[model samples]
Target: MTPANSDGCSPDFPDEALAAELDELRQLLDGTDKPACAEEGEGLVIMRLCSGLTLQEWEGLGARRDLRDWMALPITANPFPYLTRIQQTLKELVFLSEHDPLTKLHNRGAFERILSAELIRSSRSGQPLALVLLDLDNFKTVNDTYGHPCGDRVLETMGALLAAEKRTYDYAARVGGEEFALILPGVGMVRAEGIVERLIESARTLRVVCDGVDTPLCVTLSAGIACTKGKVAIGWEKLYAMADEALYAAKAAGKDRVRCAPIADLTGTPEKTLVRADEKRFLFTGTTKG
Candidate 1:
């Protein structure tokens, strides 16, 4: 005889067939213990078993309970207890990939990405952009004299100062052991030079305290500032090379000073006054802007 369906025990089935089906179901349940029913919130259900199978497999084993009807149960209240930890781990990984571990600033890769985006924006808007390259003068001497610990302290201190001194829209990245690069958007060569001068002054006055004594360690920085205006094929490489040349000039002249190449050198010079408005007042011999 055909076996009777066990679904809700239909009344159409004969008594003998129903008894045989019931016996088969009992044997199946005995071999594989029935899973415990648990409610997983307002509109969900979870089946828990004392076996090796997972929740999905156990739920597929013939559970037909409406999840919304079991909302009052608390057995499956929290499904993912480690969600916060997982999120934190992901955030840490992202930060480690994009930021420098020692200075907590943008790494060289991150800096390049930002610079590229800014370059596109500046090129489209016709706004000028400035690139400044700075290197610590005689930093190795400091390391040899005061020790590596002190050198680390100096680098950290300088990095913090540079970060704090930058404008909100500016980007500064530590590119090497004693080198840094700053990208200034919407700034021209003249303004960039002024900024570099201020940076040099600030570095000169920065004091590093070591060994519980007020050790007045004076560190000098040489910087080259280059500004670009029109559409240029060379792009960042052009600016970088110009700044590198200017930096070489600064080092050759004397360390601890700011050097800037005229925009005319990078792009064709405009017929405007080279001197600033304020500078014109103090100058004894120079053409003034009309």
Candidate 2:
């Protein structure tokens, strides 16, 4: 009598007998060099043979004697080529989504995502974070005087400058046509301000050569610097607006300067007051109260 089959074994066989049969099959496959072939109706199954089976012995094990004639058929079931193309397309899409085409900097969308994540980490770890909004002074003049090409060059130069000055952990990107934003994680306002000052000086000293002559082009930048001192729900837009206002003040006073206003100072309502002194009437629009 045949032994009973074990769990999950074929129902036709008893356990000990099925185990012995499986062992015999395994030995037969292992002792053969060529794979065992089996044909069931229209499908062909190939089992990898191990060591010593010849073509004749393999053919003898086939379910149908005529299966040997179908052994030369090629396999056509792998989808790896199509999957590879899909993977490549996905990679290109990811790159385009995350990068700015103009300056090759991280795009605003990417910047916002990264900034949010960084802010959370900084808040949890009690680390300082600095944010700077930078605008090119009189950028319109550059475009008007030369051409759009010159304007593009200036932008590329500015992007390169930021890239050079940025630390490994810092995030610098072009957030607008004439505006750039920088995120300095773990940096305080004081240090951030110093970095901005250095950048301004660098921009002022940068010279562009055109038409075989060194064109004396001076670029001035107005920067607004802020830092996260404690846990707060302050949005990046608010910080950017504050910096922009400070930048406008710098331009109004004179171009080529860095103006930084504290978050507390930015909360007050701006008042419009006119001062008449001698023959001159000056309209001052600012949050400062005298």
Best by lDDT: 1
Q: After superposition, how far is residue 156 of candidate 1 from its true place, in Å?
A: 0.4
Lowest lDDT block of 10, candidate 2 = 66-75
Model 1, residue 83: distance off in Å is 2.4
**In model 2, which regions exceed 4 Å deviation?**
1-89, 210-216, 263-290
Mind giving the per-residue lDDT tens digits that candidate 2 earns over 128-168?
A: 78778888988998888887777888788888888998999
Score candidate 1 by lDDT: 0.68
Any runs in candidate 1 off by more than 4 Å, and if so which?
A: 1-81, 212-214, 264-290
The TM-score measured for candidate 1 stands at 0.62
* Tens digit per residue, CA lDDT, model 1, 1-290: 11123344443434444335545755665697444442433332332222222234223322332121111111333435334433544687798888877777788898778877777777677788888988889899988988887888788877887898889989888878888889999888888888989998999999887664366687789998887774442356667778878888888888899888767234654324466665775585564544
Instruction: Quote the lDDT for 63 in model 1.
Output: 35
